[model samples]
Target: MDLVDIDDLSVTDLGAVLDRAAELKAGSGPEAGTSAGQPLDGQTLAMIFEKPSTRTRVSFETGMTQLGGHAIFLGPDDIHLGHGEPIRDTARAVSRYADFIMARVFDHTDVEGLAEYATVPVVNGLTDDAHPCQTLADLLTVREKFGFDSHVAWVGDGNNVCQSFVLGAAMVGLDVTVATPEGYGIDDAVYERAAELGDPPERTTDPEAAVADADVVYTDVWVSMGQEDEREEKLRAFEGFQVTTELLGDRPLMHCLPAHRGEEVTDEALESDNAIVWDQAENRMHAQNGLLVWLAERS
Candidate 1:
């Protein structure tokens, strides 16, 4: 099965996946260790990257190694796709060698295409439209901080992270309020899907209003990769959208890192006791470990 979006799985499936993640987080050894080796002892993973990454690369590569599997990193420049190879051909070829395929790319369609043609399970590392794995880690962190059924308030660009969060919240039945700049709201399709998952979310343009009484206030870089040209304009447009202490107003805040200290979030806010930025970052490892194990068991 491919994990392209949260909607692809049922609530029961999500619960099982998360429960397994929690189990692994609580002190389970490498899944393969139980049998005297890695859970994926003979498994091979082909990791395709069309974008630069630090977290995705390190986490997946190390996760695979620890799980008794090997991961081969395929950069855009090194792949047949870069040399005019069709995506279908690339997917079929990689599937022949790899037990699973993980891709970090610019277009969501590319990930979907790979899943379509590849016989192995396909994982979405990231894309311009969604970052499902990151959202998985974020939800696990929220579960740690506030327990199950916690509400999250997102204040900033309704970008890829926000889009994934909406779907993640819906899958877990957690309430979410997203505050984005006018004309920068989540894609209509995402909004529609989230609404279908459960009660319609509370959407607004006022960041402060969204965070009031919120358990977790989340924000991300105003300008994402490929958006460098809009840095100045986005800064001006997102001025009041910053997750400052004032906006947080005693609410705990979370930021996905490589953060711009003074832009999407303030240094003061990030350093506050209520901030769980570091813990969230650290949880990425544990959360992804759980994911790998879960996938291995199912595979």
Candidate 2:
């Protein structure tokens, strides 16, 4: 079993995951990983990352600790895969000891390759093609701030985060509108898939149009990890898409964090009451806690 994307979980499963997260956050569930109630007691989680991360690393490690499990962080230098070992071979070998594998890699195919070989559950911490975990937290936070039937807007690059948001919106029957530049918009294939989720999404070049009447305004860095060489070009392309406080106009806002400060969004917008970034960021840990418990129980 693997969580490569939100689509991996049906609406029922996604709802269950969120419900469990609420229980965990409310302290309504039994102590996880403890002898009396720990569902993952003595379980070990293997976390592999080729890219640098602050939240992803901390959240997963802390979630495992809180649940009475151990999380071993594996950096590029810590594993043979860093030294040219075949991904499948490494995946198979690691599965022998760890109960689950969570990988944050530059390439989506690498995560997929790992999932194909690992005997245990695999989680997509992140990838170039999708960031499902982050979107899960985003959805959860939006639900917390405002009930369903609210409109959300994405006002920057239609990257991995945007893709995941679209899919999540479709799954939960939430409405989302995205505004991005021509070359930097959502991939056609991804948009096509989203169209099937429920209501077709609106992807446009006008930032203000999307921001207007939106309950939640979200944005991400124009330049993502592994795209450093294209930073100058990206900045130029995304000049009109910055999510300013004025654009939000009292609407709550979200960013996955590690924000560019002035690129994708202005500092005013990020610090204003409209911003729920800290809560959104914190929910990553709680949501993943629920997801981990859910996956562990299945195994």
Candidate 3:
């Protein structure tokens, strides 16, 4: 099965993933570490990307390597899909050689098309619509910090990261409040799905109000990968939405890295005593390793 969204997995499955992540985090001994040497000795993963990345590429590639598997990095120039080859055809061909597929692309439809044709499990690294893996890591970090009942307050663009945060938090019974500019709210479809998963999230235009009682205040870059042209406009729109020291109050701060300092967050917030930004970054590897183990066991 493909992991396109958190909602695609049940609450029970989400819990299982997190529980295993915690166990793995606590250290499972030499055998578990050695799983990387023979975990997927004969397996291979095809990682396709149309956009540039730092964490996603490194985390997945390293995770697969440590798991005793091999990963083929397929850049845009190397892939025939960009040269007019059909996504279905590419997916079929790659599936024949790889045990699983992980794609970070500009279009969400491309990931969907690949999944439609591939026989192996497909993981969505990132797209214009969602960043499920990041959300998974964020969830794991929150579990570490404030335990399972921790709440998350998002203070920035209601972009893909925010959408996934809401869905993932709801599935795990965490309260999530999204505060964005009036015109920059999350997609209604994503909100509705979060509600269907369990509890509907609280929405607000005031970032401070959203983070007032939050255990974790999360923020992402004001503009995403494909929205570079709107950087100035987003900066203006998200002016008051930044996670500053005053805004954080007693809440711990979380920023997904490649952070645009002074834009979505201030230097003070990034350097604050309550900041877990680096831990969040490192947890990407641990969380993904657990996810690989979970998926492998289930498969």
Candidate 4:
């Protein structure tokens, strides 16, 4: 089994993962702290990360450890994919030693490659096209702040995070409105799938209109990893897209941080009482622990 994108999960399955995450967050287990669960006892997780990270690395490693398992971090320098090794070989090699695989990579195909051959489960840590884990945590955070049905407005680039957010929101029945720059657009297939699920995201170019009545207003860096060369151009295109309080209209704020602070969102909005990013950040561990345990059980 693999979780390459939010679409990999059915509505019920997504609910199960979130429910378990809620339980993990509540510390309902016998032990204390984030590392309380024993669900992955004696298991090993191979974490192959091509992209750099702060939250993804910490949350997964800490979550796996807390779940009674150990995680081995393999960065670009540590992996052969950077040295011309086929991703298939890496997948086969790691699957032999590790009980499961979690990869955060630059290419979506690389994640698909691992899932194609790995005998055990493969979890997507992040990819150029999708980010299932982060969306899971985002949904969990929103579920806590408001109910699952609360309206969410995605107020920036229609990047990978936006794509995955659409799918995750549809699964949990949240109405989403996406307002992005002219050239940027969410994947049509993602939107169509979400539409099939009954809450197709409304697409627009007006950021103000998008978040006008939203319960949660979200944004991401205008330029993500692998898009560094286009920084100046993206910055110009995203000039008026910043998530300011006036545009957000009293709604709670969300950013999957390491935010560009002054660019995509105002500092005041990020630090304001309505900002729930810290809680959103903390839920990454709980959601990931639930995901690891859920996948490990079926595998």
- The CA lDDT of each predicted structure is 0.82, 0.87, 0.83, 0.88
Residue 240, candidate 1: Cα error in Å is 0.3
Best by TM-score: 4
Task: Give the TM-score of each candidate.
Answer: 0.93, 0.95, 0.94, 0.96
Q: What tens digits encode model 2's per-residue C-alpha lDDT throughout 143-237?
A: 88886688888998989999998998888888888898988788988888877777757888999999787888888999999999999999888
lDDT of 1 at 276: 88
- The TM-score that candidate 1 achieves is 0.93
| Collision pairs in model 2 | 32-38, 33-38, 34-38
Against the true structure, candidate 4 has what lDDT?
A: 0.88
Q: Sort by TM-score, best first: what order?
A: 4, 2, 3, 1
Task: Judge candidate 3 at residue 185 and give its lDDT.
Answer: 89
Q: Model 1: which ten-residue window has the lowest total lDDT?
A: 28-37
List where candidate 2 sits over 4 angstroms from the true fold: 28-37, 80-83
Q: 1 or 2, which is superior by TM-score?
A: 2
lDDT of 1 at 128: 93
Off by over 4 Å in 3: 28-37, 80-82
